[model samples]
Target chain A: MADEKIKSPKIQATEQMKQLITEYYIDAKTTKLPEGSHKPICWITSGGPVEFLIAADVIPIYPENHGAMCGAARIAPGLAEVAEKMGFSRDLCSYARADIGGALTESGAIPGGLPKPDFLLCCNNICGTVVKWYEELARIFDVPMFLFDTPFIHVEKPEHATEYVRQQCLELVKFLEERTGSGFSLERFAEVAMLSVEAVDLWKGVLATAESRPSPFTCFDAFIHMAPIVTLRGTQKVVDYYKLLKKEMEDRVAQGVGAVHDEKYRLIWDNIPIWYEMRNLGNLFAENRACLVADTYTTAWAVDIRIEDPLTSMADAYTKVYLNISIDIMLEQLVELMERYEADGLVMHSNRSCKPYSLGQYDLSRAVAERTGKPSLIIEADMTDSRVYSEAQTRERVEAFIESL
Target chain B: MPVAGVDIGSLTAKAVVLQGREVLSTSLTQTGHNSRVAGRRALDMALDRMGLDEGSLGFIVATGYGRTAADFAGERITEITCHARGANRTHPEARTVIDLGGQDSKAIAIDERGKVLDFVMNDKCSAGTGRFLEVMASALEVELDDLGSLSLESTSPASISSVCTVFAESEVVSRVAEGAPKVDIIAGIHQAIASRIYAMAARIPTNEALIITGGVARNIGVVRALEQKFDTRIVVPEMPQHMGALGAAIIAGEHHE
Candidate 1:
């Protein structure tokens, strides 16, 4: 530390972001209501990872989902700047920066800023970052962090990995039991799983509504609407909220209330939302009546694959998502979303923030576009950093491609 | 009689207020916080530079990601339409246009008069886009203005493989650790950027006078690197960043009865 001139990028938003996150912490901490046991909370990776958590009398909060929202809100830039100011390289994903920055800044201060986690769980099937992120979080909070180590079995649904994940879910129950002084009940767990499954089924129906010719709702809306699910997924309140959303979407479809007016060409989107750009892009699509019928990111919450339902069913599904698997699974999901949405084209954002999501997307674009006789538009941009967006270039490409489609 | 164009790009908003064939004013400004505010401010600056106001214009067309958001705009044209229009106006023989903007990159193959034929765009990553260039340029402590020139000083350019911006930051750290020449690494960054653009250009047999537009056109190093990659001198229009907006304005002019 002897006069080392740090060659870090100039992070202009660092102090302000730290202040904002600290504010969120203060807001979340100062207002504490009477603790309710049934309102038990758990945070996990995806819509699936929380199933066991939900089934175990715990409300599920998806930190990764929240992380994406922070990126989308364009707040991640400031947080990343803060992280950089702390000597972390700009090389880490902004999500990691924002999360760590916000947590460090809060130090027990905002409404839900680093909420005291009763328990944390992950399938670790998605990214190597999950383990490190959770481990670090667990270390800081002194909370129980359960890791479901699923083997990297590309396609084969091997039993060992499933068993490993299942054991982790049991461990999660034990971990929760230690805090609440309650034992695991198999019957109660199954009931909770069925309820979780039912909630997801309704969510899938809502997503399916996008397939309508006019597209009742855009993926942008879905991204916001999915917030309740992430914050309260295991709760009956979440299930009730989605039921209402699904019915409204149904009514829209029946009455022909399209999210986009004069729906002409429907398209499917692959990869993450341009977080800071969903509104502009959504409006652009609406201008042309080209509904973004489905998105890979939003659709994940609605994934209801036919997996065996027992103690381990939810665990396996949670860990076996496209984020955790190879490109083949992603490609398959693309095709499925395309066909289900009845899209005339596909728009793939080759996002710079996440490589695993963007990997081989070109091939997926080509294959899906040519094989299905649907055109594809691939636009490149960062998820959070506005510096990465070329508004003119993107508009040009999107307009040209969409006009053709 | 004069026609003007404005390209309200993500990184910077540029205004090219042309009085007939004579260029009256060209203004460039950072998009800062709000694109709407930036677009309006850029137009006002350009108009002020020309000793005119918004009402003095025959018509106005807005283009770019912020085009639809332009309230003063009488009409909105897609960046594709504007880029080609701007390029064709600058170089009549131009058949292809590549616009590397702040967040994304695109290649448009156009006809003689600036109608798009086949096009490819990369919208997913920051690798080849302005953000990537800015990040790498910052790491090298080379001003955006000097990156292109610095690369020229390189004897042998190194390679950058990470398409993700975050990954590339680490990659740059490794390059520095290996003691690679800063100039060559800078040159390699330009090449990494060029390769991403070239992939889009290769989607079809791009026509001659391959005009490069958008904010990236300001990067002389990227322009030079692209020229080398394609084995041809790439065409860059005067006030290249404003091409999209100018194309929009031109379209607006044409649409006026």
Candidate 2:
């Protein structure tokens, strides 16, 4: 049944993107081996500052990304159960549980699990769960951990808050220098920051291509193609990848091709993609002629970093992320995305795993509807955990939402 | 020409036959295990009542949870759209339609022309649905139909804190063990369902001229409880469970025309 419903047209770049992600994971897993680049492995959060590690010639590994891989492989439930049996609440972030379970059991989609981290770096900008999730990793691996605290932006990004994060960036530099027993050159950091900014710009351009009518690619494509921007940021490869992707999308748009056949409704998605059900959902929307053109999750990594003062700008950009901001600000951004994409409606994933992303979604949905007069549908499911997901319920709501539109 | 609509829900199947705007006949039956068979049976029963056969129907539309299983249906529409169309046909002034069915519940907002503007449904949980009341009825050893009348006798409704069906059933048992009146406990169960529905419905812009439909609408206790919660009069149509089927039949007639 799902096979027939999942016949959404695919983008040509998907094959290249899959190869890129596979190579990225293989490199991370083999970093410490004799045949691999003998670089130190540092486990970092998805929203953590990776340019610093990249500049220092350290391999930055994202357990959150690995959790997503586990989810996509349909092994997250078994991995999460290991943690659940160990007294971790089922309500904890599935990413954290899956990662911990993968680490403990040494079993996941990837062979030998993720390489042991020499150090752990976590940022609370994404969610508070990472603070404890990384701490647990630190305890399990007996490694040094750094918690780069970014204060929640309630109304505005205050100067002191930016300064606070700026000071931590400096501390992070020193921490890397002392931990690696090497001098952290400002010139090298600036170069990596430049590449990071360039990649972000290209990624933003890639996403903005969907602004064209009958968008060439849906957010499902973005969710899969966003690997490099999240994992390989501050590198020439990410910039090159986005250039290729952006051109493909532009060519598709010029050829009058749409992600969904005979696109009837365009929608903006909120929160994270349901990692496990991406194909099912993508196909479901395509079958309905509804294209999820824009989303807030992948767009979170498209930050604007100024090269004039790399440290200060990076601090400000990282401090003011999509998930770290207030609901009112989120509404404004969502409304902007809706207008930019000419969306007919909104779909919000009320993820049970990530509180920061899912909380206040109801209010945000209401505000978006009031501001843009567009209806929003909130589907409850975890980002990685499929146990909480009800396929029948989700299908009913999604079909009903599309019907209403 | 006559058109027919079949609604194969999780627990029951309903069918309605319509000629122009007037309802010719309606039938209800247990869905049992096979939705496809149940859907055919329902439509056949309604056709029997009207002294007609499948060949006489101009069009057939299927709806409800098991709409997809009805391969015999010429068209399949979701219950949300069907309920909105059904309620709007019955009460043209109604803008809000609340449907509490066997295993799920939904609150739909429709335009004056019976087009769905927005809707919200209870999540995978069965707390605010007819199944919850059925479980509570079995736990309290009372007939499901008599629950509404018995609850009306309660001077003070007992408090059911847990909204989960399993937990609430245990709460009902404990209340009974403590010698609390069954009427009060039943009233409390209705209030719990009302509150759950209210929280979900409040997410949308619920307007006045509200109509309640589905099997649970027969329970006056829940209807009155919802009326008090929304602080508005809720019109329960004569054949609440048949609304989805009737709406499908109306849509079928329109399609045929």
lDDT scores in order: 0.72, 0.91
Off by over 4 Å in 2: A1-6, A33-37
The most accurate candidate by DockQ is 2
Interface DockQ of candidate 2: 0.75
lDDT of 1 by residue, B1-257 (tens): 44456667778887777655556777888988787888889889988877888877887777777776778777766787788888888888988888888877878878887887667767556678888888887887778778878888988998887677888878888999999999989888888888777876786558557888887888888999899888888988877787877676667667553
Q: Once model 2 is optimally superposed onto the true structure by TM-score, how far is the C-alpha of residue A352 displaced, in angstroms?
A: 0.9
TM-score of chain A of each: 0.84, 0.97
For model 2 chain A, give the 10-residue run with minimal summed lDDT. Answer: A1-10
lDDT of 2 by residue, A1-405 (tens): 455443555677777778887888788776664765467889999999999999988888898888988899889999999999999999999999999999998878889898889999999999999998999999999999999999999999999999999999999999999888789989998999999999999899889889988888999889889988999899887788888888888888899878887888999999888999998898888878899999999999999899999999989999889989998888889999999999999999999999999999888888888899998999999988999999878888888788878
Q: List each model's interface RMSD.
A: 4.0, 1.0
TM-score of each model, in listed order: 0.69, 0.97
What overall lDDT, based on C-alpha atoms, would model 2 receive against the true structure?
A: 0.91
- Give the runs in model 1 whose Cα sits over 4 Å from its true position: A1-41, A68-82, A107-112, A170-180, A305-308, A373-375, A378-405, B1-73, B85-95, B99-106, B111-228, B232-257
